[model samples]
Target: MLRRRLGVARTLKDFQGQIYGLNNLGTLLLQTGNNQAAAQSLVEALEIARSVNNEEAEGLTLSNLGLVEFARGNYFDAIKQYKAAIVLRRRFRDPLGEANTRNNLGDAYLAANLPEDAAIAYGLALQLARTTSDTPNQFRAFRGLFNSYTEAGNYPPAFRALNQHIALAKEEKDLFQELIWLRLSAQLYTITGDLANARSFYEQAIALARVLEDTGEEALLQNDLAQILYQ
Candidate 1:
């Protein structure tokens, strides 16, 4: 209704709103595996954001573009987009946006196999999230750190980071985070040679993933469980 009412005007405000709507649609497309369509939508939205000189919208659209690029295995491009978004969000004093951009930066670094750089990005993201008191971002940052440390062969820090992520997830009552924490905890346990705990957590994560209808995560849990069993 609002979109229809604003259709004739099509002012800068309308363009900005359209940018937001398109960005959101792009995110949904990305999550549903339509990377090409997501990229197109994000690019269109970014153009509109630029035309309107909407810094906040531009930053968010750039972040969405970064996600699409990252999913498409264009890590360097994704990092560049994320870095630009981070600069804009920082200039605007948008801590939540900054945290999200940093998290995306961490993802790009991780994808590029630069775990130490990923760790640094995640650490900055975590600190910013804490400053904003954003529980979800805090959980994501901690999860990033956990993955970075694990890939870097820093088991102790990985385990500690995983524990921090789990604690934050519990505080937020986030079922998805709980599921991820369980899965990662299982992997960490296996790596640390805690076979019994690994098996137990893997089963728990599998059950939770089933309940959540998260087939991708369930598949990962199954694979990890198989590997642990073989070990």
Candidate 2:
């Protein structure tokens, strides 16, 4: 369907439709792990967007390019692309796009072991996501903050961030994500010697997993609970 759209766009000389089709193809390719093809498509899309002076499309394509770089472990290059996208997003007054790119930047920084920079980026993303009432992005920002703080050895802040992420997951009714967060909370509590909370969260996670019929996860949570009990 997307290839057909691209073909139709070409036949019609619809630069906008061509750009959109290429962008969608790039994103789909990336999601399917075809990074090389994704990069090619995104690069073409970016060129088209630039030619048309479409700042929004340019910013979005740049951000997708950053994702490709990030997936290849080129953290520095990812940061550069993300920053470029962020500049364009800000110029367009696209708060949500800027916030999303900031979160992506935070992920790159975290992967690069730059916890402080990751924290800063995630903090800004969180603030922007809140302002925009972007609940899903807010959850991502908190998850990033959790990883950043944990890597920085800031346990208190890390737990706070995890709690926030869990709250958002629950609010969104994302049971699978909530179960994951619960297990993470349990592990953190256990590491902190808060055995009571650990057991409670593990039990909650186990129960939730069972309700969802995720036997693998339920078994994992049960094993974790058993360890906590023995400890």
Best by lDDT: 2
- Scored by Cα lDDT, where does model 2 land? 0.91
List the pairs of residues colliding in candidate 1.
Answer: none
Considering summed lDDT, which 10 consecutive residues are worst modelled in model 2? 163-172
Off by over 4 Å in 1: 1-13, 173-176, 203-227
Model 1, 1-231: lDDT tens per residue?
534533533554668668877887789899999999999888988998898799888999899999999999999999999999998898889999999899999999999999999999999999999997988789888989999999999999998898888777788788999998898899888888899999999999999999999999899889989997986
Per candidate, the number of residue pairs that clash is 0, 0
Clashing pairs in 2: none
Residue-by-residue lDDT tens digits, candidate 2, 79-169: 9999999999999989999999999999999999999999999999999999999987898888888888878878999888987887788
lDDT of each: 0.89, 0.91
| TM-score per model over all chains | 0.81, 0.90
The candidate maximizing TM-score is: 2
